[model samples]
Target chain A: MNPRLVFKAALVCLLLVLLAEGVLTLAKRHAPFFRLFQNQIVSCEILDDLAACSLKSGRPLIVVMGDSVVYGSDLHAHGVPHWREQALAAGLQRQLPQATVLDLSLDGALPGDYLGLYAAARRLKPDWIIFEYNYRMFSQKFGSPSEAVSRPWLRGLMSQPLFPALPQTAGDKIKSVLRKVSQLYRYAEAFRDAFFFPSREEVINRLLAQVLPSRSLRDPGDREMLLKLKIKPHYYTPLLTPEHAGLQAVQLLENELRRDQQPHLAFFTPQNQEYITEIADPHTWPRNLAILDSILGSLADQKRFFYWNWGALYPADAFYDHCHLVPRYNETFAKMLAGIIADGGRRDHVQRLE
Target chain B: MFNGWNENIRAFLLGLAFFLLLILILIFGQDLSSSKFIYVDF
Candidate 1:
């Protein structure tokens, strides 16, 4: 073995890898490209991204948190897909141009996610936290733990023990250290998908669309089928009591936020009331949110913590389906939220950033 | 021909190709999204 030749080759490879990582790191700073792969973000990986997130010091930061209702697909909209740009955060950004809006929401996210998200958002030092309080979260009928909550990283977040009793394996320790050191290794999926055309998902989806009947996960075109087959069973389940994992996670998130003196605003996720009544048993389902509403209402301090039931506020047309809002309605939703966050209930701060 | 400078350059190119291919496969081969995840399991 020639040590000199090996060293030269190793140095060349290292430089090439570093060069690639440098480009990805720089591209991740640009918000549009940065958010392109936001779906793949796990709880554990958020802090590093937030730490490197650059914002103008004077600009007030508003972190919007929730699930698909807060960040829905643009599959419904024709012409071209704008994805997150047409979602709630961008709508809020438009409404409150003075402040920077960070959409920390994801598809199928639950209350169990917010603890990890809030933990990550604290790094951003946000002025206001606006989130969707989806009533469906109260239903433990989904999965025992749910795939959303059982993500490898999220499994650990949910298992927050009083002591560091859990043992880490050799591989876990190495991965943890590597994640801390290398953004490339940590978000390799995001970087690769962003750089590749017709991404790996798109490729699989195109191929799968051939053999499988359903092509997309949240295809807006599938609403009629979703309503007939899936919606009733999913939404009409009995509300799990206070002991529900999601409710417990919500309580913990609220408690931590209060301890940190962080102000937050949450509205009962608005749905198409017309369609809801069709599936809902009237006493349960949608009423589950109302039940939770009274419970949350007991602790409501509008000055610091704002929670309201806004489920029936919008018309059927306002929603893309039964839950998510259309882009124009999203702007309306943003305006209403901005009014509260800017006014601070007492009109303490400027109503708008400019 | 085996002892020529061209052979050394060819070997370096071959090694670099193998390294890049390995990296590319590792990065893009797998689907991170859950296979059995149903969207309506709200």
Candidate 2:
């Protein structure tokens, strides 16, 4: 066969195979395999491109940086009391009475995403930036365990034969291409699942069935401590030990604050009410805050870093899960942050050399 | 050069076909509004 003929034949075969796969996927939209992929779509649609999508509105910004727990997983299911960005805005306005709030938080984000956030902060220049993280998120590889959860959809899509065959580009063009075909199957399967799979409420019921009892874990004080030196519940020894992720993130944040000349504050988000009680107990809580104290001490003795221990202020029911504060707490946290920003913050405490 | 150009052209055409399909879905398919993910807004 001539070279052109050979090329044409291969091209035709490739098209035939994709067409066959596409047809098979559509025809079996009711099948278990097809249905599984559709559920994956529902999850992916919820999870996709979070960093870009959350910031689409041009409101004032309050970026939440951390892991799955800080992403407001529980808050999403329960309505935001004031509504998320709205709640932050309200809290700030209630405090500053003149500020707006924007929320730019992606669940499962690691330190790498913070670098992006630092740039966004430089550009958008929000009144405040709230960095929240939990114990489980810190890890040696890829910075957090949320990567493990996010990887399945990403890995599934990437492993598809079509992903590698495409011309590589600066963006996720290949997934976007496959997503077109996948969405067709997604709708077909979602329809069938709607009929035979389950209603959205039923699916939620089934999902909640798997949420381990909140009481299965110990109370705040009794919960296992990950860091011996730190008084906090769980501390992953600085990613900067063999290498440092948090320090690098701090440098970026500091540079941004300096460049923008915007005041910033750092506060520990007490995940549970019990954590608050534990931190308040003079016997141990103050010791746990030693890490934070060191951080504050290093920063020119300025009180710009406001450490508000709300653990004692809120009760247990305020948290929906092990780590997430219910919407009311989110409001209170925002209100407190807004107050600090309105005060022109504590950097005033820093002594200046003439 | 001709063969390489031919391969490039073939891949581009195929990729373009997929891209067009996505545009159609975006225009016609059900709402992938993603606002429902409001649970954990970015």
Best by DockQ: 1
Clashing pairs in 2: A60-A102, A76-B39, A105-B42, A231-A288, A239-A243, A240-A243, A240-A244, A276-A311
What would the per-residue lDDT of candidate 1 be over residues A90-144, giving only the tens digit for each residue? 8888888988787777555677677767766686778888868776666655334
Tens digits of per-residue lDDT, candidate 2, A214-271, equal 5322234422342122333233333223133443344444555556665455544454
With candidate 1 superimposed using the best TM-score fit, by how many Å does residue A59's alpha carbon deviate from the native?
Answer: 1.3
CAPRI tier of model 2: incorrect
Error of 1 at A69 (Å): 1.6
Model 1 bad stretches (over 4 Å): A1-57, A74-83, A141-175, A192-205, A208-223, A226-228, A281-283, A345-354, B1-33, B36-42
The iRMS of model 1 comes to 5.6
Q: Find the candidate with the highest lDDT and give its number.
A: 1
> Per-prediction count of colliding residue pairs?
0, 8
